[model samples]
Target: MPALVLAAAQTAPLAGDLSTNLARHLDFIALAARHGVTLLQFPELSLTGYELALARNCAVTLDDARLIPLAEAAQRHAMTIVAGAPLRLGDDTLRLAALIFGPDGAIGHYAKQYLHPGEDTVFLPGEAGLTLTLDDDARTRAALAICADTGHPEHPAAAKRSGAAVYSAGMLLSVNGYAADTQQLQGYAREHRMAVLLANYGAPSSGWQCAGGSALWDENGEHIAHAPANGEALLIAERRADGWHGRSISLD
Candidate 1:
């Protein structure tokens, strides 16, 4: 398989600043493009910022004006992009989910099905999750998840059963209580024999601190690439004959 460059975008989104967040995302996209990255993954709730209460006003439809520029950019750069967003699914619901834009301007979205308690009060649970090809040419079957989705074994199991070769999530992984989940997530990937990638959030909000250290773990229980605790970074990983290889892309 051709090497796949997966970027983990860790950032703290300032509520209601879609333009600024988009601008930052564009810069990271450009940087990843320069590295010949095939796909770029960002933290959950990246587009609208992760402010829950604020997400209502920031939530947008897939065809909304905000996504146009991003679609164009993805097409131009030939990079598959997945990031978190709030999409207006109905007159009464907002789904917290990951939206994918292919290099050819194709759009696919995955809603977060697994809710972490309080999420039920604010967002509508996703009716379905999606698995799409990561690279159109090479065509690696891929599935996406949001923050808490990765922590649950059932979600990843569902992805594997759904014909996904690799599972990816834009997780807002917190520094505290992460070691246990990280280990479990890794074990799940290894046992299921699937590749996994997590893009953690860097800038903490809600008085909750996070260590934006993105991680990549392959089949057979091996961590190929990861960022240190609490920082912004771009992690690059490759699929090889034996398993996988990876490193970090320094944004200097």
Candidate 2:
């Protein structure tokens, strides 16, 4: 298998500002393109800033016209972009979802299957895990999970059972909660023998002081790369013949 370059982005999206947030996403896509990143993942609710109260109004469908720019960017750069947003399922239901856009177009979505206690009030949990084949070689299969989903051992276990070689999560971990959260992520990588990637918020949003340490772990559970907790950053990891090589780029 050829080397696969992936990035985990730490960003601060403006609350309820879809246009501004999408513009910010475009900027990140452009940056990732320059670095030869094939896959780029953003923090949970990155489009709408993790504001539950505004989620209903901000919710969008997979075909929402507002996402055209992102699709075009992905196609132009030959990159796959995974961005989080509240998704409207029906007239009255919404799910916290990660929208996947590839070089062709919108590919698929992963709705949060396990919700945090606070999330239950605003979003519905999905029933299945989402997995995607990253390339034609079919050697890189990635599974998606949301914030609280990573806390459950069964979630990653199920992903492993489904043939996923990589486990990726989009989350908004608070400053004080990052240590425990990251420890669990490393454990998942070690136990499941799957490469792990995490994207998180870089600045305060929805009244929480977010921890900006987006990171990646190798299959052996070694920390490959990690962004700083103080500013917007991108952690990139490339799988090589020897192992995974990684670096962090400051975006602030």
Name the best candidate (by lDDT): 2
Ten-residue region with minimum lDDT total, candidate 2: 101-110
Q: List the global CA lDDT of all models.
A: 0.79, 0.91
Per-residue lDDT tens digits for candidate 1, residues 20-48, read: 88888888888888877777889888876
- Model 2 ranges with Cα > 4 A deviation: none
Candidate 1 lDDT (Cα, whole model)?
A: 0.79
Residues 17-134, candidate 2, lDDT per residue (tens digit)? 9999999998889889999998899999999999999999999988899998998998898888899999987576999999999878765688999998888999989999988778
Give the residue spans of candidate 1 off by over 4 A: 90-92, 137-139
Clashing pairs in 1: none
